[model samples]
Target: MNTESVDAFQARVAKHAALADPARLRIVDLLTLGDFSPTELQAELGMPSNLLSHHLRTLEGAGLATRHRSEADRRRSYIRLAAGALEGLAPGVEHGATRVLFVCTRNSARSQLAAALWQQVSEIPSTSAGTRPADRIAQGAIDVARRHGLGLADLPPRRLDQVAGVGDFVVTVCDNAHEELTILGGVHWSVPDPLRNNTEEAFEAAFTDISRRVNDLAPRVHAA
Candidate 1:
């Protein structure tokens, strides 16, 4: 190999070296599902706190993960898969057996963003609704969607009663909505309601989370 080519290969090797350990690989897998605080990671991985931090540091060096402090709780740091970190391993192809219905309390943010993200990532039909539809979608949700290259200019908050049986696959994005719509028989994300915080960052975080989960959930949603 030419000197330049050899250097490139070496760099590639170095980047992937961080993932050579099995524990790091598992950390990457968990981050794919959603962002987790160090405490949460320790509980999930049953690893020592200091060791988990070491793995996260390695991931950061390799550009495979990023960390952010929660705006509400600065003492907590959340670790998420970095931008494009999962592109090499993301799920492909939608399960077309059942249309997907995204649900939350207000349908102002989480469910709305989830459905928009699902549309961008999957071919299967998807939409959003709420337990108690807001009079209007949150402007922060709209702003964040636009920033993420999604348009929510016309999508409105829809009531759950109007869409209870609209789809065979129902994914609830809030704890309350999950309990209220238990008969829907799909997964519940337990995602926080961004409107309660009403910050640009909060809305962006909500969008990022819903987008990640929706992308991951698409491939496994085949109807029974």
Candidate 2:
């Protein structure tokens, strides 16, 4: 085999080795949908802090997971699956929700695109909101949507509390919104803010990321 193929095989072997333990596998399953802090993982797993830390370190060393400081609370950190870490892995468990509510800091780009993409793929009913909303839907988002043959509605951005309802599956699409929210039972995707660059490439990248996530999640979530 070529060097590239050999390297790829070794990386896959390492990832599989890292997940050999039941505790580590469970941690990966929890992170398949959302980010979680050590405290939260500890609580969920009922595992001691020391043991949890060891597993997190092993996953990180294997390049299967990452830990980032919270954008809201600098002292706290969240653990998330590394990008493409679960490629070729089985899908996680199913979820039931009345609707899917996508959220971001400004509700200008990421959340809007996510909601639109989700609607195209699933019948679970989806909408979007912001923690601190922008004055209008971003032009960059509109352009990207048009390129993808999707329409971003002309509706004004809404605040989270105004639109979110019980049974809604909340997905925070940006790091800022995810860190700011203390909400329980929500998913967090650490997608970068594309609007910061305000370029076609940036918006397209954001759209692509959300599109993959929507496709991955749509089948797993069913209307309650």
Candidate 3:
């Protein structure tokens, strides 16, 4: 094999090797659902922090996963599957729209993240509104979005009525809002609201969850 081919072969081998440990494999599986901080992973897996850290480090070195420091809290870190990472190892599901709308209770956090994330990947434009709009966007949410490189500054929060209407692809990002509105033919994702505690960790967790959902849903929205 040529030098380039040999390097590619070795990289694949390294990726495979990184998953050899059952703990690492479980970490990857959890991340597939949504990004989680090291603390969250420990709580979910009931594993030691040191052990989880070791596996996470190995996964990062193998180009299988990556971690991002929270803009809200420097001490906290979120681990997510790297783009194009483990592409061939995992089965791909083949899975779009226009003027997509994201909704939540306050239009403060979850919905905003979803709309911004969708904007990045989908050809369709997106907007966010809340069933009962808050006076302002949560500072923690703004920090998280900034970390993701989305400039959410000065974006005014809107009420659901302001943006809701037929022919709009409405997606509710809160369980309560989804259950209440029961938007006809609208998609719903039960995302946690970080504003409950108004903590940086809460916002970061919400951002990670919303980011994953938005990316996953982009294709379907664009195809519509």
Candidate 4:
């Protein structure tokens, strides 16, 4: 190959190489829609901090991703896809139908709302589960969805393991879940749970917060 061809070939080879590992591929899948910090990635992927850090560094080195320290909290850094990485990875593919998984300590509230709103707004495939599954979906969650014209009648509280196989991205909707459960191989979002108050107003606020996060996530979910 000529010099230019050789470099082009090498770039493509590296991009594909970066995705060779299951964990790394999962990271790419998650970042295709948004950014995450190292700590967040560790919890979401359920890997050791050092291992997750190494993988993230590798991805960033390959120009597939970028990381920046949080302005509000310098100790934290967020990782996101490099500007053109998605287009290069899956040229011409439509991303509107991506699948996502929402998680919380209990599947009754925050995660449930996230999944329902995501499905309603993006028209994408989504599911909700808990690290410690709840016996039933929260009525507050149901009420919030109904207020937004989304239905939760058919949705059931599920365990993380049950939906693991179908997740393109896995987001933890509360700090407790984000800190406690070790997420394995999926995108992570750290959202606070609304069930703490157990009040109708609190549920409404939680629903609103989740809806906003879901909207921000829609582009990344649908980006090809």
Q: Each candidate's TM vs. the true structure?
A: 0.60, 0.87, 0.57, 0.56
lDDT of 4 by residue, 1-224 (tens): 44658777777678788889899999987675445777767877999998988898888877788876543355766777775674545422224334777788788888878877887766567888888888899887888788878887476678877776542566776655655654453445544455667788888888776776576566555621
- lDDT at position 67, candidate 1: 82
lDDT of 3 at 40: 68
Q: Give the distance in Å from residue 93's predicted Cα in candidate 1 to where it truly belongs.
A: 9.4
Task: Rank candidates, TM-score, best first.
Answer: 2, 1, 3, 4
Pairs with backbone N, CA or C atoms under 3 Å apart (clashes), candidate 2: none
Model 1 collision count: 0
The best candidate in terms of lDDT: 2
For candidate 4, what is the lDDT? 0.71
Q: Residue 172: error of model 4 in Å?
A: 1.4
Q: What's the TM for model 2?
A: 0.87
Per-residue lDDT tens digits of candidate 2, residues 35-113?
A: 8889989988999999999999999998999998766677878898887898868465479999999999899899999
Residue 39 lDDT in candidate 2: 91
Local distance difference test values of all predictions, in order: 0.74, 0.87, 0.74, 0.71
Error of 4 at 43 (Å): 12
**Lowest summed lDDT window (length 10), candidate 2:** 178-187
RMSD of each: 5.8, 2.5, 9.0, 9.9
Runs with alpha carbons beyond 4 Å of true place in candidate 2: 1-4
- Error (Å) of candidate 3 at residue 223 is 5.5
